[model samples]
Target chain A: MPLYLIGLGLTPDSISLKAINIIKNCSKVFLDAYTSILVSYEEMTKLMTEVLNRNDLIQADRTLVERDAGQILNPAKDSDVAFLVVGDALCATTHSDLYLRAVQEGIQVKVLHNASIINAVAGTGLEIYKFGRTISVPFFEEKWKPVSFITKTIENFQMGMHSLLLMDIKTKELDWKLYMRGIERYQNPRYMSCAVCCQQFVDVLNTDNDADLSVETKQDFEEIRIHAAKAGFSVDSKCVACMRVGTDDQKFIYCSIGEMAKLTEHMGAPLHSLVVLGNIVSDMEQEMLNLWKL
Target chain B: MPLYLIGLGLTPDSISLKAINIIKNCSKVFLDAYTSILVSYEEMTKLMTEVLNRNDLIQADRTLVERDAGQILNPAKDSDVAFLVVGDALCATTHSDLYLRAVQEGIQVKVLHNASIINAVAGTGLEIYKFGRTISVPFFEEKWKPVSFITKTIENFQMGMHSLLLMDIKTKELDWKLYMRGIERYQNPRYMSCAVCCQQFVDVLNTDNDADLSVETKQDFEEIRIHAAKAGFSVDSKCVACMRVGTDDQKFIYCSIGEMAKLTEHMGAPLHSLVVLGNIVSDMEQEMLNLWKL
Candidate 1:
């Protein structure tokens, strides 16, 4: 009896052959529903069910995964259990903990790695080697607003490296609560868009002065162009549309930070990421960025 | 006609169903041979050939890819061409350039992302968010020995962020040259082992003094522990044996830099990566590293 932490990749069609074979043979299959949302959950489920020729797929919510770990591991001890994740299994630290726990419990675990947003951001034409520590931008609350990510971004900028910002997704907790109350409440999942992230960035810059910067530093920050990429996993095209945002709207073809902050139009769909460019070293990189220029 | 850049993942079994399907339907399939090597090329080829029922697969060497990308793109003008990469397509900047070129030529392109070492290193129990810029450890040449990576690693250490040093792989260049000369040269491909990397690290530290620092910085560098991982893509187990190396043998369970420098043992296989730890942040990371302590 072994636990298989299989990566389902990005799209429905992105599932690997090895993953498919394992899922078909597994006694129980559980999809981790909390970490990050895939582009199309229904299509993924339909594809998995149809390919595996099995129903009764369980959706392991956050509470069940975080609280009741034994429920999954206990079953794994007796039979083959497939715990599927949207991206690569180890991308989220929680999954690594689960793997460690299973190992400690003497339950053999196998990880099937797949594409994650961490590496897929290379689709933006930005060199992956230039990327520094990645950060996540959560929906800010009035009482608990965090601007530490700004400092990290600044550090990366100083070192001539890009910073990838993962926007937040709020799904499972609300869904589980509604389900527990037996109410037919359908609250649409909230995905932080680039527009919202830009606004938040501006808000943090305006309020926070923890970094202790000069007026020139603030001016340099304003001039720095940011990239907003949507649906990086889309198979329709090899390249994803990355919008370059600067401070002056007239300087760039795309929207500036002020414009993006007040933008009403969405980039379309969930799972959008932002990239703050650092020092552009190579001519190729400069050429690629110029192509996206407004 | 369209071109599809497909990531083959870590192991032979890591190939996705979408990749297999696309390969089966592709008019011509070419494997990019130089960027990064998979676990076993023979095993991968066998698995892919058997699954696709095709044996006429071409190996796209570095020259064919970087210098003459037109050879691959020209075929896609009226047919579906599948260009396979070991990890993710965009992980290497060359593939990004290829995608850009294909787009410029009015050739529709699709990228099927897969697991890369960038995200897979999370399995080493090191926090991915705490990793800085990745560097490569190349075999030093007499006339041209570059120690710039050492500077980058030290920069990462200063920021309390880990550095992932990708070991170099030399395969196709020598093979192609030998073939062109009509000489039957059988040189086993060289993979930079952790032992060799450790020796090089010490050699660079002793000779290169680019980072002007005090004696305290040198002492701090000596105390930092490094992790060497091998067979990371093995499907038999989820965990990879990550050996922790410190300055003194008594400080850690694994070998010290001096010990590793003179070690004769090989870590096994072609693909291996080194992780030099930064400042340990959490109790979890400390506990995990302690497990590897002597």
Candidate 2:
């Protein structure tokens, strides 16, 4: 009885026959709901009980998976246990800790892979071969904004490699305040949109580097222009705003980085991703980009 | 009426429920066998005819797709047509040419994504976020050897980003010798192995750059060492050799570049990939690599 790590791809029907059969035979099935969610917990429940006709589904939240993994792994020692994940099992937020734990416990482990946005982003007609290191843009809070992803994007641009910026998703997260008060209230889910991501990039580009602090009139517009140029991208740099990729209602918008910031209210839905075009876009790539131009 | 591009993932059963249903209903179904193959034609025919209970399967080779794409797109104007590809529909080979052609002809196109080695390689426990631009290693001929991939791997190494080097596959390749003489024949399929890729990397490291031609004793080992150091990697650098990733028989071997090069005959079957580790590997990544270390 091996512990099966199964990937339920982007769409509900994207699950493979191998995964479905494994789910059916497993003594216990745990769906990792905290890292990401393909659909609502209710919808996934319906998929399992109604479609898969298996009622052994167990919802594993962040605390359950990260802090109390034994609830899922312990049973695998004697019975088949299935840990279901959205997208390819190991692509997005890694379950490596759990996998390592399983290995340490001498549990036979098997992984079933499926499609993930890491691969599905190719549907934008941008060749996967040219993509550089992927970046994750988290929702910026008032005091804790991070611009490392923006800088990395600039580096990718300088190297003539496209950047796939994966927007962050917050689901079933416990509010720190609530947790401190011994109340287990979960916060509303938040999914980062391309608008937010682009605005952050623009913000980073507008700011002067710490090294430039010694310069006189550091806040001057001309000074900022030189710094932005050094950063490798600008408000007018081309970017592709993707919404709900690998779904029927998928939408793509090709526009300047600054222009994308204005699409905050209309891009639609969760799971948005942004692509910063590198300097090496080929004629064919440019043609494909034109199909979604604003 | 629409032209559907469906991905049959790494394995035969990796097909999705949506794809199976779509294939069942499509008036004409085509398996793009030239770009890559998941299983033999006879096995796939059995999968479609016996498993799916449909007999509309058409084998679309390179000439049929690249040369006579109209054969697949024409019927899509009035009836449903499915073009099946091994791995994720767009990840490996860009079907953008065929897709753009469909759009030009005003044919509606729908793509169904599935798992491909692009995302599945994350099973190696190297965070997908740390991967740089992918490089493809082709079968080098005696007179047409290219070392551009080696240079790119070095660039990825310098950037502290892992490089996923995709091994080339030659499926249904035309025997150019026979084709020129009007003998329509395809040579046997060949899939690149990690052993060959590692050996090529070693060969590139052992050679001095063209600029060194002006210097006397350019072939000296000390001169090659200086160039290899400037190139950012050497025989002792770490790499992960992957065989048949995303499948049940998937195997991983983590070893030094020199040791990997020596594995010329034992890495096992087709669809192999190599990952050149970067300088920034985390402790968890190292632990995972230890699990498969040679």
Best by lDDT: 2
Residue B213's C-alpha lDDT in candidate 2? 40
Model 1 chain A scores worst on lDDT over the 10 consecutive residues at A244-253
Q: Which CAPRI tier for candidate 1?
A: acceptable
Which residue pairs show collisions in model 2?
Answer: none
Best by TM-score: 2
TM-score per candidate: 0.78, 0.91
Worst 10 residues of 2 chain B by lDDT: B212-221
* lDDT digits (tens) for residues A86-107 of candidate 2: 8888887668899899999999
